[model samples]
Target: MLAAHFDAPGGPDNLYIKEVDRPVPKEGEVLVQVHASALNRADLLQTRGYYPPPPGASQIIGLEAAGKVVALGPGADGRWKIGDRVMALLTGGGNAQFVAVPATQLMPIPPGMTDTDAAAIPEVWLTSYQLLHFVGKVRKGETVLIHAGASGVGTAAIQLCRLAGVLPMVTAGSAEKLEFTKKLGAASGFNYKDEDFGTKCLEATKNVGADVILDCVGATHWQKNLQCLNTDGRWVVYGLMGSGEIHGDFLTLLLRKRGSLLASTLRSRSHEYKEELVKAFTEQVLPYFSPGGSIQLRPIVDSVFPFDQIADAHRRMEANKNMGKIVLQIPV
Candidate 1:
């Protein structure tokens, strides 16, 4: 099997495809012949030597992939069978032709959805679902302020909020990106470059502030996050894209609002936690991805690059050029 590999910690240029021994399915795991996979910020950080794979996880970088089950490991046969088409939420090793994943983490691809689209769902959609429901415990009719509204998880969050009857607002870098988010169900979109989103969001909500805040930009968004959080609001921080440095009375403001400060990363979660989350997502959200479902939901695939062009895919994501998930088609 061929997989994406890096010789040393560095940029996208350091990535290359190399022949590696195919992994045998471990207990409770299944071997998947991957058809497509997608990029995430963690992949970037890993290649740059910032993030290392969790204990005993594959060192390969991709966090998600969609493929066919080729073989099942011990204790994995009851739920899934050989040749079942599925999408997997992986800890790593998804950037390969063959990767082994826990069978419980695999969900059957919804009818009529392409592998390319399915490849985009696992990481971003599941993360958004986890952040909004599991971590934040958001309820209907509440307003959520989401930063990075045009990225993969941001787009998924916008749609999921609308589905849950929550009002969603966003912050993006450009007017075009903001417009796109509005069409996807954002109640209000703020250009983070031109204005203080805190003030704009406050105005959008008539100074009542947000019930929950889903933030990926950390340090730069701290003060403003405090500015617009409602009393007893849940502020979930999942990523620190702007770096994790907070200045000035962080606790005082949080205490003033009685806000619950929460943080999580789906990739690093225990298998039991991920299995349950995957099951919840399968029951609650997977059906909507079908065209004939009551409320139709779609995975946003911004671009697809062949396996060899992995570096280009990384560059596009690094430049913030992708509006949604950037996919990589595994070599057949």
Candidate 2:
């Protein structure tokens, strides 16, 4: 098998493909012959030595994959058989031709959904579902202010919010991106590059503020996020696209509002937790992607790159030029 490889990485220039031994399924695992995978910011961080695969996880990069099951490990024979098309939520290692994934982490590809689309679903959709439903405990008619509104997770969040009857407000850097988010059902989109998104969000909601905030931008967004938070609101921080460090009376402001400050990461969570999330998403949300669904739920794919052009894929994502998940087609 061949997979993306990097040594002492600092930029996309350092990435290349290298032959590697394919992994075999362990107990309750399935061997998937990957057809496609997608890029996440975690891949870039790992390349630059900022993030590494979790302990005992595959050292290879990639967090999600969509492919066919080739073999099943012991204790996995009940529900799956060879040649089942599935999308896997991986801790790491989805860039290669094959990967071994826990059977519990695999979701059957929604009917008529392409591999590229399925590959885009696991990381962003599942993460968005986790944030909006589990972490934030958002209710119908509440407002959620989402940072990076045109991102993969952002796009997913928008549709999920609408389906749940929650209004979603988003912040993007460009007019085009904002429009794209609106088409996906964002109630209001703010151009954060020029305007104050927090103020815009308040105005959009009649100065009532947001019941939840899904923030990926860290330090630069901290104060504004706090200001826009509704009383007793849940602020869920997942990524640090901005600098991680912060300075200010954050605790004081949060206490004054009686708000809850929570942080979450899907990748590093326990296997059992991910399984539970997958099961819930599979039961409740996955069907929305199928044709003739009552809602407009779907995965947003920005672009698809060939596996050999892995470096270019990284460049596109690093430049923040993508509005949704960027996919890679694994070579046959």
Compared with the true structure, what per-residue lDDT tens digits does model 1 show for residues 231-306? 8999999999998988899999999999999999998899999999999999999988877756778899999999
Which residue pairs in candidate 1 have backbone atoms (N, alpha carbon, C) closer than 3 angstroms, thus clashing? none
- Among residues 3 or more apart in sequence or in different chains, the pairs in candidate 2 whose N, CA or C atoms overlap within 3 Å are none
Over 1-332, each residue of candidate 2 has an lDDT whose tens digit, in order, gives: 99998877688999999999999899999999999999999999999999989899999999999999999999989878999999999999999999999999999999889999999999999999999999998999899999999999999999999989999999999999999999999989999889998888888888889999999998999888887899999999999998899998989999988999889999999989999999999999988888786895888999999999999999999999999999999997
lDDT of 2 at 287: 87
Q: What's the lDDT for residue 186 in model 2?
A: 91
- Per-candidate TM equals 0.99, 0.99
Scored by lDDT, model 1 comes in at 0.95
